[model samples]
Target: MRILILTHRVPFPQNGGYPIVVGNTIKGLVSMGHEVSLISINVKKHSGRQHERDDLLNKISYTEYGIDTHISVLEVFSNLFTRNPYNINKYYDAGFEKLVLQNIKDNHYDVVQLEGLFVGPYVAAIRKNTTAKLIYRAHNIEHQVWHRLAHQKNDPFKKWYLNLLARRVKKYELELLNQFDGIAVFTGEDKNAMESFGAEIPLCVVPIGVDMGKYQPEPDKTECPSLFFLGSLDWLPNREGIEWFIENFHKEIVDGDLKVKFYVAGNSIPEDFDEYDVPDKVFIQGEVDDALEFVNSKSIMIVPLLSGGGMRVKIVEGMAMKKCIISTTIGAEGINFAHGDNIIIANNAGEFYDALKRCIADEWYCREIGENARKLVEQEHDVNKVTRDLVAFYQSVI
Candidate 1:
């Protein structure tokens, strides 16, 4: 089958879960001998000087890691006039869809994979022109993430406006789902979440996979009892997760008798955002390029996410790295694993503190739990197995 996949980000480098999922999915499809072409949406948040901008313009933009890569970077003109959030501008088009339409007409693919709801509008018209099947990969309920941000924001006017905008966008996003032939969700819970939002489309679950070889527990243990939190901080949930960790976990653990340094690292932290202290116990090393290496270097991975959709792929990554997890119940959601078995879950400050202590001091327990967790990821989230299942789902839909 000849498939055309569209994504909201460059899926190479796999710094964030969305890219990791899309990049690996393309690999799986290509391995099955299906001809795949990718059209990744590049929403570049330029943090550069005028000379740097000129340099960026000259930089070689190459085809990323899909089978037959077709990259198209998009920029918005209205962005000059509008100060809308990344959650909005990331999906906003600057005529890339026209090129996509032209390409679709020329190639006439067997299937068109839409990566997220943000790209829904672009592909809605693609269906009208072609006889190809459309697979809408809803990474998460996009509106819910915005809603969480609205609630978390202290500024009343901003919170109210964000919430209102989310409600409006969600209605549109929900309507767009019906435009596609099949909708794929990260978790069963997400599929159900969509249904609760009145999504009537045919939906299936495609769980994210772990590259077991790269992430699985190594023979050598980490040197220090360091707690780690990793994700692309540009995402609201990751920021919230770490922010919550600092407020809740850092407060209780910083002055405590236990001596464990905490590392908060991820990708693409905006400079305007505060990179402050958590009582000298926490180091906010925002956006580490190599996540698994960072995860392995830590004794425990702490996830204090309050609200978000879909599975925590990082938790699975941490599990693969044999780092005992200290996460909120919400943070640990969607991965088909039990609390005490594969990970250690905590809801609040006290419980998180306790989980951290257990992971820090108890070497034997850590080894056993970490080993078991690694095994669980291998059994349940092996990339090859999950990819096969995803292929089966696509085959069924086709």
Candidate 2:
């Protein structure tokens, strides 16, 4: 099968969530003897280094068009008058659309998969240009993220604006539903969300998969009674989650009897992050060289996400690395895990604190949880197995 994947950014480097999933999917499909081509709109932030981009080019057929997605005050104000979603509208480039059309006309593809909702605008062009089965691989229900963000906002005006943005994005999302031949979501929850929004088209769950071979568990290196949170801080949900955790539970944990430490590591750590008067035990190590190494060093992985949609790839990676994970219900969504068996689900600060306490007090319990997590990943998220299922779905859609 010949597959074409369209994404808003280059999936090389795999430094962040979006790239990791997209890059792994491409690799998995190629390993299964399927021809894969990628058309990506590269922004400055996600363009990655020259060597990283070269590495990707060596592996698969990829074409990237550079675009400026920087948000400006003028664009924001102007978008208020239009019903179109500012976030999705900014990604619509005439040149990129022309390039997509030309690619479709030149190469006969069995399936053209839009990697996320941002690329949904290009569906009409692809539908008209080719007879290929169009698949929308939804990473999340885009508008729900905003709706959750809106609910979290305290200011009335900000909340109103966020709700408005969510509505506009929702309208655009629902409008694009039937335009695709099939829809692939990261979770069953996402599929249900789409169905409730009147998406009558074929929908299937395709959770994010990782190459387990790349992740080797180093249990000996694990630091007992230590906790760490890893993710891109530039993303609202991650930053919000970390902030919420610190504001609500950090002091309690620090002042408690246990001498446990919390380490925060990720890309794009905010400038004002240091301004917070956090305890000395809470170490902020922003943007480490090797993510797996960082995960291996930690005893317990914490995901205190208050609001977000879709699956958290970091959770899957941590599980693959055999780290005991304690996350909120929202954080662990889309994953097939029992609350106490494979993972620890904590919805509020009290629950998170209790879970952290339990993990710190008993080293053996943490090890047991970590082992179960690794087993879950092996059984459910192996990249080869996931790609085979994806290919079967493509065949059914075709």
Candidate 3:
């Protein structure tokens, strides 16, 4: 199978869950004797410089399009006049579309795997030019963000603007679904969400995979009183999740007569969230090199995620580290586990506070839940098995 992979984010570093998943899938396909060619956008570098995908894909070939040193005034003006969300506007460049069309016509790829809706426009361009199987991997329903933003919107004009943007994007997303052979979502929840939207294509659920070898539980995890929350800061849901935790749960556990510290680790802390103003119990560690290393010293992993879609890779990563997970029902999106079995789930502030306190008080119970969670991850979300299943799905679709 000659598979052509497309994604908005560069699959280098394998840090953020999405890019890492795509990068790992490509490697898996290649290892399984399939030809994998990737057409990815070069992610904007922070210091106005060039970026490198990690050594895992050092030999993995790809074509990088839409690599601007920085966003220009012209692009901003165009996006503003065009009414496109700034999120999608940056990816709407000519080079990405051109390369996609060229690959479809010249390469005769077996399957064109699009990483997210951001690249949906290319599916039609490819289908129009060549005979290829198109599959869109919905990382999460994009509209969920709009739903959250709509709630977070305080201003009338701002709320109206976000509602309008969400409406437009949803239409684009629905139209894009008509152009694909199938839709692969990261979680069962996302699969159901797409179905609810009336997506007629083959709907499949494939959860995120974790490198169990690196994320295995620690032998000394029984000796910490810390909690962790990790995600890519650029994601609005992550920001919203953390903000909700701060405003709602920070005191429930820390100030509610429980002796615990919250360690929030991720990239790009909104400048306003600087430490000078953060709650005393919350430690905002911006962008650590390795989240596991920072979290290894914690007693339990916390996912007060109020809103988001897809399986939380951070949850699996923490479970991989052999730590007990305490998350809201919304936090534990994709990974299906019943209460008191593999994880401890709480939906509101009172429940969340009680769960954390109870887990902390019962050392034996915490260990049991943590061990069970790790076992579930190894059995279900291991990369080796996950990649095998993904390859089989691709083969079937092709």
Candidate 4:
């Protein structure tokens, strides 16, 4: 099978989030004797990192177009006069559109997969140019993230603006539903959500899988009673979750009877994050060199997300490394995890604090949960198995 993957960013380095899923998927498909080609839009922030995976890049046909996706106040104001969603319209580039058309004309592809909702703007052009089976690989329902953030905001003006964006996004999302030949979502929950929104096209749940060979658990190196939060700190939901945890539960945990340390590690830590008055036990280690090593060294992984959609990749990575995880219901969404069994569910500050205390007090219980987490990922999220399932789905759609 010859596959073409179009994405909004260079899915290499696999440092965090969707890139890990996308990069792994391409490699998995290539290893299974399928020809893969990639067309990616690279922004200034996430560009120039593809060199880290030159070996992977050499295995497949890859092309990238640079674009400025930074938000501008003037552009936002101008968008109000038009019916097009400001968020979706910004990703539409005439040059990129032409490039996509030329790419399709040069080669024949069995499937052209749009990696996320942001790339939906390219559907009409691809449909017009090629007879390939178009697949929309939805990372999440885009509008729901904004909708949740809008409801969380207390300020009147901010809330109104967010709500407006959410409304525009929802309309755009619904409009693109039937444009694709098939839809592949990361979770069953996402598939059901799309169905609720009147997506009657062929849809399948294909969760992101981790490469087990690279993420083996090291139980002996685990730092007992230590808690860590790792993700892209520049993202609103991540920054919001961390700040909420620090404001409500950090002090109590530090001052409590148990001696524990909290570590924060990720890329792009914001300047304002330093303003929080946290204890010495709270170490803000921004953008570590090796993510897997960092995860293996930690005892417990904390995901305090209050809002967001799709699956949390960090939680899955932590689980694969045999670390006990405590997350909110929203944080643990998409993954089939059981509270107090494979993972600990903590919706509020009280529940989070209690879970933290329990993990700190009982070493045996913490290790047991970590072991269960590892088993879950091995059984469900191995990369080879997931890629095979995804290929089968593509064959069925064709």
Please, what is the whole-model Cα lDDT of each candidate in the order they appear? 0.71, 0.88, 0.75, 0.88
lDDT of 2: 0.88
> Candidate 2: misplaced stretches above 4 Å?
48-56, 253-258, 276-280
lDDT of 1: 0.71
For model 3 the local lDDT of residue 342 reads 86
Q: What's the number of clashes in each of the models?
A: 2, 0, 2, 0
For 165-226, candidate 4 gives per-residue lDDT tens digits of: 88999999999999999999988889999999999889988887989999977778878879
Quote the positional error of residue 304 for candidate 1 in Å.
Answer: 0.7
Q: Rank by lDDT, descending?
A: 2, 4, 3, 1
Clashing pairs in 2: none
Task: Give the alpha carbon lDDT tens digit for every residue of 178-261 in model 1.
Answer: 777788888888898878877676788878886677665554757556767788876777877677666655555567655788
Task: Quote model 4's TM-score.
Answer: 0.96
- Give the per-residue lDDT digits (tens) of candidate 3, residues 193-235: 7888888888888777766767754657445666677787788
TM-scores of all candidate predictions against the true structure: 0.85, 0.96, 0.89, 0.96
Least lDDT summed over 10 consecutive residues: which range in candidate 2?
47-56
CA shift of 364, model 2, Å:
0.8
